[model samples]
Target: MDSRSVSSRLRELVKFLGTVQGDLSNVTGPPSLLAPSSVVEVGHAWAQRPAVFAAPALESDPEKRSLLVLRWFLTSLRSQLYVNGAPGVSIKKPLNAFLGELFFASWTDEEHKATTQLVAEQVSHHPPITAMHIADREHGIRADGYARVEMTFNGAVNIRQVGHAMVHIDRYDEDHLVPLPDVKIRGFLGGCMYPEITGTYQIMSSAGFVTEIYFSGEGMISGKRNSFQARIYRREDTKRREPLYEATGIWSKGWTVKDVRTGDVLEVYDVEAPENAPMPIDIAPLDEQDEWESRRAWAGVLAGMASGDMRIVLAEKTKIEQAQRQLRAQEAAEGRKWEPLLFRSQEGEDHAVFHELTEGTGWRLFNERTKGVWKVDESKVVGAQSPYRGELTPLG
Candidate 1:
């Protein structure tokens, strides 16, 4: 893509992210990384009305105010990826290439910042909402000597995906770990909640490669409008380790990682990708899911590639390992195992019911209206009859 087009697209994203709000509840990995209550709470607020806080709001919600601060930081650091360019290190898709790893790397880290008066005018808007307030703390240099930066964490130190990375901090040694809720974290949390994102950049990354990927989606969450754009970029990394799988769905599944060029397909369990399913399932892995209750780490390896002085290395692909299986134990019943079988007899106009048997319940009926919850003794449900193998797929 040319500098003009890339800049136009990103500017739109910035505008859009500015509008929506989202909550990123730390679903896995560590509690210390983000305050449990706040992660979800704040993330939801940001995702829902992200734009409200982008521009100054005369009358703003308190929660929205805090989110505005966080957004500022993300926007700024994204600008830096491009600014940090040397001669051949051309910036391209400043945000995508620079922060790809932190968020979810799908391409080589390259510069994509455009150098133009209008681009500069657009970027010269605001500052990041974060900063290293303390001198020495959390891996800072020297016992008391620290090197703190005010760079864009282009990535959110908060927020967690439903089935991806982000786990409890307590798992890795509770004593040494400090929860994000502690006042220490809140006060120093990115520091300077005042101005967000270091004032916009007049410049961006210098050189980089962009992949041919595009994504567009719209939905309603909790009765609010939602949308997203997935930008993918990749450069020939003969050195970088090829992914275990080709991300045929990357364009649709947000930013993702894969070893499309490698000989191995990373598989920790025996499973099959169910037709039209978001993820594959395996009954075997479910048994060991509890061990990773609080945390589970994936194997992240560096694929060797050369980019200038820094050896071109693919970012680590670490995700919160989750066990997805039908729980034999019923959520309602104490110790009984629920079966996955469904039985029905013709009644009325072919009325049918779906049962999600768990450990305790015996043939519990599902309520379609109640989101398939088997809480009640039985609930009247509709649309449970199979269409006799005749299903209408998405419209072309």
Candidate 2:
């Protein structure tokens, strides 16, 4: 589509999205440019490559294990931004997730003989935050994190992620803190909107290794899009002149890692390689899924969007929002507060592992920003059910 037509379409979309509940004011335009999936599904996209996520568990050496973790993070970044960065397919606003909404998926890693499970929930609605937990019990790898987009319009749409994730490997007793990056969705007014992530982010581990990654697309670094450079060095080194390993390339395609001392190739990760393909995620059939489940709850809205029926999309979306409002009102009238079913707010040293890992680093929990430092409350997950007192809240 040309810029003129795209501009008109974007204006209409922005007007409609502005009326939606929660923080959706800064979404870029055009229905055709929008993702058919909801935000909860988008949250699960980061961990789509399950084999890469489980790779670190297979490495026994501390240095190799650290590099594997960095590889997993880079691979996941490609999965998360591939749609927005791809040609023809560009930046599209996803449906905002409603509070209490749940998403569940799992994939089996044949090589590891392990099942990796993912659970994500819309823990907050006003500021719009999604908390996710992924665990491979057999491999003893667990990652817990929350995210929300903070958007701004300055010619182009600038999006900043407002949370952090921590991954813990049980075998090594290591904790790795992963930080998010800043992204810009450009070319929107001219019709073909695309995303570019530009900034520096890091992965700090308790094992005393820090992987500093810099994303400098186009003019800043190379003339290519999605270009990045990463260095893995000891935490004590402030200057970081001598790194143990170095990685450089475009994340959308692939990157190469080299041993700094030996000047030998270490690993090459290609995004389009058959081995890097995302494993199929499995979920229960819609008929058998709980009313609170994301797929079941958003069935009507998703179907509407897929069929290009805006009427159905608006009606179904409004119905869910209204029910949530009424539920909140009832709780307020009874002088009670709504609590998350699968997660709990963490305060102080409740998450001692995370605190210890992030001690010297500039990173912080940002509890106030996310409403609370949300962590999985395993006790509540047993025989999981809706937290609502009476019947499940009717959605869709």
Candidate 3:
């Protein structure tokens, strides 16, 4: 699509967003704006790509592996900055996920013969919180967490992503806690919508290493767009006068890592190269997936959208949504609550693990709007059929 056409589509999307904002005026929670695609599709957009997560599995050192995991966490931010779709399509709203909706996929590392599995579930619907668990069992690496987006409009849209993720290296008995960043949508008046992430997030490890990453946008005088710099230090160093490592780069493109004391360059991650590009996730066939699986649940709607039939898309989407609402109402009338199949809520004593890691960090690990902190049920996966069926496929 040409620039003019893109701008026109963006204008239309903005107008629709404005309508959604108006409708949500009396609502107390996050705004739900239905896009041309389902929330399941957009969830994949923010997921950690196969390449980034797979790289950490190749390393064995706790500290060095932790650093690579941090790199993957930073690189994952790039996914949130740009929308995925045909060329020139700037902003696309993501459909709200119904309660209990699930999205499952896997990423394979061909060279190492390793596979990383991802299981994401929409655990709550009112405030729309998503819980995701990723594991590379072969490498004894696992990450589990949940997040919810809270948006506000004041001329432009300001979105705050509230939640945290915990990465565990079972072999080393080490854990890394990472936080999400806030996003700002600009160019409302200019008729083009673009996202800028601005915030400072941290990656803290149980192995006594902490990395503080700062993100900033282009300034009128000196700074560049999507620029970020991170400093890694040991926990026991009270003075924090010296950093063990320093990383600098534009997040969307790449970053360079260097040792502070030795002044030796470690590694450079360039997303532009074919070899360094992210690998695609493999998913189960729609027919073979469970009824609640994202692809299976939204098959009709997605198929309609792909075929350019707006009537079919809207009708199918509305049917699914209406059915969900009816189910919720019936459950409410019967005084029963829906339970997630693959995850369980963490209550009082269960929060001990979260508190232990977040202590002194001044970070709220769980969003108050959510039902409760969530954790994956490992037993559910032990004998379960893998949701993904194929080899590593390159993502477009």
Candidate 2, pairs of clashing residues: none
lDDT of 3 by residue, 270-343 (tens): 86667765567688887787777777777787777677786787787778777877877777899987777688
Best by TM-score: 2
Cα lDDT for residue 163, model 2?
A: 78
Question: Which is the better candidate, 1 or 3, if ranked by TM-score?
Answer: 3
lDDT of 3 at 57: 58
Per-residue lDDT of 184 in model 2: 81
**Superposed model 2: Cα runs more than 4 Å off:** 1-8, 11-33, 83-87, 220-222, 348-350, 385-390, 394-396
Tens-digit lDDT string for candidate 1 (1-396): 475644554454334434444421112212111111211012111112222222213213322222222222223221222222221232221111100001100111112211110000000001111101111112111100001112222332222111100111111210110011100001122221111111111100011111221212222243111111212222233245232232222111122233344534332211122321211111224234222111111111112211221112123212111112112122235664222111121221222211111112232222221122211011211232322113311110
Query: Could you tell me which 10 consecutive residues in candidate 1 have the lowest summed lDDT?
Result: 116-125
Candidate 2 at residue 49, lDDT? 66
Each prediction's Cα RMSD? 27.4, 3.1, 5.5
Ranking by lDDT: 2, 3, 1
Score candidate 2 by TM-score against the native: 0.89
